[model samples]
Target chain A: MKALDSFNPLAVFVYFMASAGIAMFSMDPVILLLSMLGAVTLFVIRREGRQTGTHLFSLFLFLTLTVINPLFQHNGRTVLFVLNDNPITLEALLYGADAAAMVVSVLYWFRSFSSIITSDKLLYLFGLLSPKPALMISMALRFVPLFRMQAKRTDMAQRALGKYKEDNAIDFIRMKLSVFSIMVSWALENGIITADSMAARGYGTGRRTCFSPYKFRPQDALLLGLSLMLAGAVGAAMALGGLEFAFYPTVSKISPDFLRLAAYIAYALLSFLPATIEIGDALKWQYLRSRI
Target chain B: MKPIRNEKLRRTVRYLVPFVLAPGFVALGITVFHEKRYAFISLCIAVSAVALFATGFDKKRTGSRRLVIVSVLTALSIVGRFIPIFKPVTALTVLTGMYLGAESGFLAGSLTAVLSNFYFGQGPWTPFQMLSWGLLGFLAGILAEPLKRSRVLLFIYGIIAGALYSFIMDVWTVVWYNGDFSIKLYLAALVSAIPYTVSYVVSNVVFLWVFAKPFGEKLTRMHIKYGI
Candidate 1:
């Protein structure tokens, strides 16, 4: 129960966002490796061993993705060998590595985020999220499993109708063939049901309130305060553009190191926002229970 | 509350809508999509394909109402693609795909690309944009039915689709722009598209996992009722 409530969504979101901005600022393998390692460490501590391993594997994936075109690609300076007269240069390798690093960091960040945010928390964050547009989005997110279950059921039903095959690929192909019609039908019917549900619930006419199982206790206040501080720091850094950099022509000139470092510190602090919120809430609840 | 999806009105819309599309297609081609004569042809074919699909699948318990609702949903999903501030392509397309068929998702995506490129001074990308965005939508549409109800699965799908879409576009650019087709050039091509690919893929997941079921389903329902 503690673990369930302890999962932090904002921590995951900011971690990835910072990763995005950071990826642009620096394509250094070392920087990327550091971030990846940190993310892996968090996963391990969380007992998400498999995820840690999965993200850790990104280094290899980065290699494969980068090496593909360059080994086969034929671009860069300091050509190592001519593959059928195509010059494969060191520059291309570096470029590939850089691209790979960026991609992997982003991927890892996302994986971390998804693990933390549950469907229900997402709803609470967005509110019952029921303006027609909001509701549709919420439904799509919710529909994944429902649709999958329905599809599984539909497939079984279709198989009974003699519409499926046994071979894996063949079965897939067959299912794909018949599934479209049924899926569309279901989506439409569900769309109608959902719309009716919303209208029946009296949606869109006025400001609507939402009910959430989770709420900010004293910890929420602390978390919110910390989040604001982090934001303000990063905001100040950006206003002065302390984190800007230009590395082309091998002339790497990074801006005010102090501010950049400070910004990064703030970014790192924000990554703990969700965790802080969780722990804070846990503490308050624990105290209240003890009092009771 | 208001009946957004009326069967009779949907039936009427299917026949009436495609007629006005030719000019729109042409305009989309030149001014919007910015392609040559070939773009016009492809756009025409694409529009007809959409209309035919709507009518053909109309009676399969999947009436035009669903099609129309999902199409509008798909279109709305296009919002995130255009708005970088809250760019949630995964979330948007997942919702779109969940409701609309893969074909509709493809149609919406391709149409969005074609239409949106207009803002960028529509150039050679009309057909290319159509193809690239079409594939994304097609993928979303195909996966939407099964994944509509599962945010987790939908989010994952969004990630894969985003990467695949970027890969496809990279290949296209290499083929179109890089005449030599050498390994180095290919590597360079792949490398360059990485940022766009990553951003798009991430956004797709973020959007889908976060919004698909709640907002996606609601708008779709409204469209069914409103007919727009």
Candidate 2:
């Protein structure tokens, strides 16, 4: 699992996209539960020994989503209670629970995703597909810190010139706006200089190619293949109505058969692959250390 | 005659994406997927639309100076998102559109969402945010003459931009919740989202009112001085 981050950027990107896509699209209770467990486990493993508020926040969101749905959505067979001429249905409650689970699961997956796929990896991916946008993104990213520093400098200079007044909300806004305006001018001026220098250095005179340290290794190939296979199976099963569930007028029972069970297992394995890899790697490390 | 026929075919294909393919996706999502896959379908639509717009921008012969200026504005708007209760991203994007051009505006708006999400956590909502803000800038560019002509018109456009942004986001909310688009559920979501929308509108109006002249004058000055 530690090596997961070191794999080819495409593999990691595809794996996360597949997992998150399934998490969002599928409403099956079993699939959602698996996704939540997988996501939380990966998140906890990655952020070990830290005080994580993610679980708590996810819990709060889950409760709020679950409770809020019954208020607005009143279509169901079993009536739970009535508040103001609106009957809260058991179906709506269940639907809300599933929806909440799906959301929380997706949230955790993305949390782990952000930690794994850093800007460099994303840039590599972008550079592979489109060079110009990738260049623009890198340029924009570089400018962010430069602009921040310039904004600070501009603010200090203004203060030094006896223009610092934040006596009220309006005044505070004025101060910020003035600083931002000045920074924009500074940035644009500097940008033109940079562009002129770039042209002088013959930036656009040749085909652009960026250096990337990541190479497609055999392990990356294996990971990519496995993720694609699993995602494809799940997606195909879904398209064929193998894992369909109705939650509207009435909640449908899950009848587990061959294709349905296969899809569910495939999704579970796909989501848990990272956590499983982590555990395996840790166990191997501990065994080697004890032997030594 | 043959070349003219090919040109006519090319034009039809160019218009096909937005005119035919977009609505086709919606119809297919509703009829075939039975609306259970609407969220994914709508996400695909948003992603492709953004891709189309981006490719269009890339095809234009944008100078390195213009690119760098766009990057700078993108960075500023991204940093502006950290401010509490009010963000100048939209106002700045509109100003960029009005001064620099519509394509620059769109690029800045979309790039702000994508790059800032590095800190804010990327999710399915990123595409929707990019589309909403990008369109706001694009339209601002289209209406730049009139908007720049009058303060009242600019403020009105600001309000509309804010409302339009929030309402487009609500489409995501409704799709995520119900797994499809339902008018009743959409209305419910809109009602619940009123407070956020109102604040969005207020902040946009305030940002534009305060920052418009300074930013505009500087941008216009740079356009003449630096020729970017």
Candidate 3:
């Protein structure tokens, strides 16, 4: 069962750029809420529930941001309460929540983004522009896990050599520093070897050829076209002031006009596109299994 | 025929691009424009341009060796973030700057923030982290000779780098809280972040004191050997 994530790297990249770009840039609460809902739906569909607990920090951040805004900003006319001679306004609180939603939704979108676009896909995208930075990124990504493994091995070797017998804090710090230095020296040595190998292979001598497994299929084109169209529609609406809402001074009345409604629908559709694709694939799989 | 002039151009660009041009665009975006979106886009563009230019410059001179070294250093910085309290990222970034040229150091610092954010979660703060660390690395490179000569200077720079990082991040905080930048709000934000800023300073100084010598020695050896 191929999911939307298995599409061409360009398609995934475009989809995320559009969705996350909108999620980060749009300030309207309704648009932000829809984006958040869509992002959460995708996370659920992807069965990333276990990772949700780790995001509690972001939730804390959202809450803190939301609470802190009304304290510092007293721009609205309708004062909700007075705390320590400072007025807390409804507009300020609402604005805080909206801003917090923007941050949190963008975070969630990026969470799914990183999962969907692996390092190879990222490199492929970057490689199109310049192969040098792309190569650097790929190497850096590779070295992260490699260095972690080396650090662990160094630690284990040090422990085996009875270096961990020191029960004092200073000695523990000294031991850790020594291990880190060993790791740094080892990494430097390995890097030279890699550089030599790359040179021997004539890495910078000619135009680079990209050997990616991803292929742009008809469906990928269709999906990309649809995403662009949806994004374009949303952008047009925003340009036309259909999604405009002022939070400071006073919360502006949200006029439920037809164009605004259509824009909201388009944005919701765009944001939820990944979840829809995943669910549709799951349903089709289940239906085929049942028929069999 | 124009080789000497070209060398002068390269030398000027090596200093001017990251320190002047990049921060200039970012400042223009934030101060000249009222739109937060444009400001953010400008910041991103500036950071990316600086990173790409630095790496490109390094690649032209040292080829892939500098790239590999920067990547490895960035990886180490990322891994250093996993250490619970006292993060060694600033120390390592500074060391890389002191050993590898400023361009490699800037690339390593910026790349570390961006790459580590993949695991820590990305937000608007990611670019700020990149810019702050990148600038710190750039400064370290400019001061590399003196820094390498004196441990005291290195530790002082580490403290300054930590403070500078916190200060820049607090600007982002103030802007996020209030839709626009205000000096009063920024001051308040700084005051509020005093405790965290102190911790950052302490950790940076402590880590630099501990890790600089060993890492600097190895990196110096590698730099001489590989000419990277």
Best by TM-score: 2
lDDT of 2 by residue, A1-292 (tens): 4746877888988999988888788878898999999999998877732435767788999998998778878999999889899999999999989989988899888888887888888888767655567788998889888888888898888777876565778767678777876777778889899999999999878766666888888888888899999998988888778878888799999997988899999999998998987788889989999998
Quote the positional error of residue A278 for candidate 1 in Å. 8.9
The sequence of per-residue lDDT tens digits that candidate 1 reaches over residues A1-292 is 1342353444333344554434323334444455555454445445543664675587688787677545654444367777877787766666566556655655555444455555555545434222222333345445544656776788888878875666678787758646634655565567566666666767545544454556445544555566566666765665564544322223244544688778766766654444444456668889999998
Model 1, B1-228: lDDT tens digits are 122233454466566556755655655444421212232345354545544443434334433345435544443444335566446544554455555566556555654554344333233334555666666667766766567656667767777877777676665444332222345555677787788878887777765654555566455655566552
* Predicted candidate 2 versus true structure: per-residue lDDT over B77-141, tens digit per residue: 88888888788889989988888899888888988998899988898899999999998999999
TM-score for chain B of each model, two decimals: 0.63, 0.87, 0.79
lDDT of 3: 0.78
Query: Under CAPRI classification, how is model 2 graded?
Result: acceptable
Q: Which candidate order results from sorting by lDDT in descending order?
A: 2, 3, 1
| Candidate 1 CAPRI level | incorrect
Q: For model 3, how does the per-residue alpha-carbon lDDT over A98-194 read when each residue is reduced to its tens digit?
A: 8888777877887777787766777777555555666777888899889888888999899889866678888787788788778888998999899
lDDT for every model?
0.53, 0.83, 0.78
Q: Mark the 10 consecutive residues where model 3 chain A has the least summed lDDT.
A: A125-134
Lowest summed lDDT window (length 10), candidate 1 chain A? A128-137
Error of 2 at A95 (Å): 0.9
RMSD of 2: 4.8
The candidate maximizing lDDT is: 2
